[model samples]
Target: MAKVKLTAVCKVCGSEIELPEDVMDGEITSCPTCGTRYIVRLKGEKVELEEFKGDVEDYGE
Candidate 1:
């Protein structure tokens, strides 16, 4: 199958970003405008971008 480029608006900067069709679910992508990272989600023919939340860990402090 041929790869198709897709577009999604950034949840942070609201910038329309082009996403690669080969991008898998849960993949992280960053916004070029605000430099915010987001997780890509695929819902049928629609695409959703969610802000990335990092997992917390203790460094034995």
Candidate 2:
């Protein structure tokens, strides 16, 4: 049997982002085109992507 691939559209660059078939919810995935990070959300048999926000680190200011 052949392995199936999952895909999602990038919200920033409108490109296709390939995902693993066993990808889990809350996993981080980035776009190759725009380098935008997204959080994977699995709802039943559907997959949803949400933009990820990173916390800024302070360098001893």
Candidate 3:
């Protein structure tokens, strides 16, 4: 299997989180800094760029 680069932003505290490739779909994880909760989803088989929109976009590029 290949490694996937996953990232998500904290809606509560505005923190950016970079998830590991193993962090699969339907998994609920919390932000390391602020403890904000989020769900890991797989919109496609490969990584999705459009997923990191809004607050999460800054840290990505």
Candidate 4:
């Protein structure tokens, strides 16, 4: 049997974002075309992507 792949569209750059079959809720995924980050939301077999505006921590400093 062939593995099934999930995909979502990037709202920023209009690119297709591939999601893993085992993806969980609150999983962070980013757009390859643009640097926009998104948060994965799952509810009863429904999947949704929301823009992530959380602060980025700089550990290099």
Question: Which one wins on lDDT?
Answer: 2
Shift in Å, residue 43, candidate 4:
2.9
| Residue pairs with clashing backbones, model 1 | none
Error of 4 at 27 (Å): 0.5
Instruction: Order the candidates by TM-score, highest first.
Output: 2, 4, 1, 3
Candidate 2 differs from the real structure by a C-alpha RMSD in angstroms, to one decimal, of 5.0
Ten-residue stretch with the least lDDT total in model 3? 47-56
| Alpha-carbon local distance difference test for all models | 0.80, 0.86, 0.61, 0.82
Question: Per-residue CA lDDT of candidate 2, range 5-60, in tens?
Answer: 78999999899999999999988889999999888998987889999888323211
Give the number of colliding residue pairs in candidate 1.
0
TM-scores for every predicted model: 0.75, 0.81, 0.58, 0.77
TM-score of candidate 2 on Cα atoms, chains taken together: 0.81
Q: Write the per-residue lDDT of candidate 4 for residues 1-61, one digit (tens) a residue.
A: 9986778899988999998999988888888889788888888767789898765453113
- Model 3 misplaced stretches (Cα beyond 4 Å): 1-4, 45-61
**Whole-structure CA lDDT of model 2:** 0.86
**Candidate 4 has what TM-score?**
0.77
